[model samples]
Target: MTDRYVQATMDVLGAARDVFSGHDTWRPLEEAIDAQLPDDYKALIDAYGPVQVNGHLYLEHPANPFYPLRTWISETIEDFRDVDWGEEDSPQFGGKAGLIPIASTDRGEYAFLAPGNDGGQSRIFSCGRDEPDLYEHRMTFAEWLYRYLAGEEMFSPGHRDFYPGPVRLESLPTAAGDRSSKWYGQERST
Candidate 1:
């Protein structure tokens, strides 16, 4: 079932056949986070690398130093902590301790995983801008991805809608010195 879902997601996203990093690349991140990333996420990254879905959602990839999972998680947590959750209009960032940001939207909304809950399998929590705003989905990352790609409104329910279309797969831009770029004249003149 999970394999089917992963394949479906890849098919829908029009991802390339070769973008995966080896398991060795993922080991350090798992060790740092002290949790095994969802198989679905690993598979998705393996097929698509890091990508922006529909020009809105951003998923972290381990290979991209700029937006690696570890860095994004830590920075997001710190930023969330700095926000005042006391205000009625403020978003509840730290309401659920150990909630890790997995995906974020362009509108400052995020999808989190409550690893401390449900015996560590993780539950999906999303904070959106609307009444009955914060909600949890008792589904695995794979299932949630399937529903999301299917435009089922699984996260925000009636408040959000997604139209299924040609999903775009974009490579995360690396830093100037990170690699030799032919376009930037970083390649050695031979």
Candidate 2:
């Protein structure tokens, strides 16, 4: 169940084959947030670390020491506390069963992992720039991420197609701070 979409994404992106392959690294964050993140999401992050997709979308890394995930999630949740979600009953954040931020874009788009309304499965909830209503995607993190990478309009409303060139994953240096290169990346092979 966890490997399907993640594998599809890895195949498309040509990411490193060696994934982190363990949940021990996420236990602290899981305990802090009191929620379990999807296995595919964890696997993807473990493989790719923090990366900027095509120079816009920034996927946060839980293991980034520079910007601790706990602080980042706390700040993200706080930033949305006073927002007008445009829904009669808005979803809460940072609680035992609340939504958690996973990524964001320069254009003010936010992607969150939310507890499934139907069951305990986790799903993606997105908020577009200047868009008050949250768009729910009843899919796992890897499913949503794979769609986004493939140019599906999973988050935004407009019909912006896929990138002109190969999908470029610009690795953020913070995750691997000791590396000599300030920035490095891999492009999806043709």
Evaluated with lDDT, which candidate comes out highest? 2
Give the alpha carbon lDDT tens digit for every residue of 74-185 in model 1.
7887776575556676543432335667787777777777665576454788776533355788777766776776667655767554554455444555454554211110
The deviation in Å at residue 106 for candidate 1 is 1.0
lDDT of each: 0.62, 0.72
Best by TM-score: 2
Candidate 1 accuracy as TM-score:
0.73
* C-alpha RMSD in Å of predicted model 2 compared with the true structure: 3.4
- True-structure RMSD, every candidate: 8.4, 3.4
Clashing pairs in 2: none
Judge candidate 1 against the unseen true structure and give its global Cα lDDT, from 0 to 1.
0.62
TM-score, cand. 2 vs. native:
0.82
Model 2: per-residue Cα lDDT over 1-190, one tens digit each: 4458878887766645232344355888888888777788877787776667777787766767666666778899999887876777788987666788888888888888886455855579888876877788888889898888778887767834377546676666564444422233335543
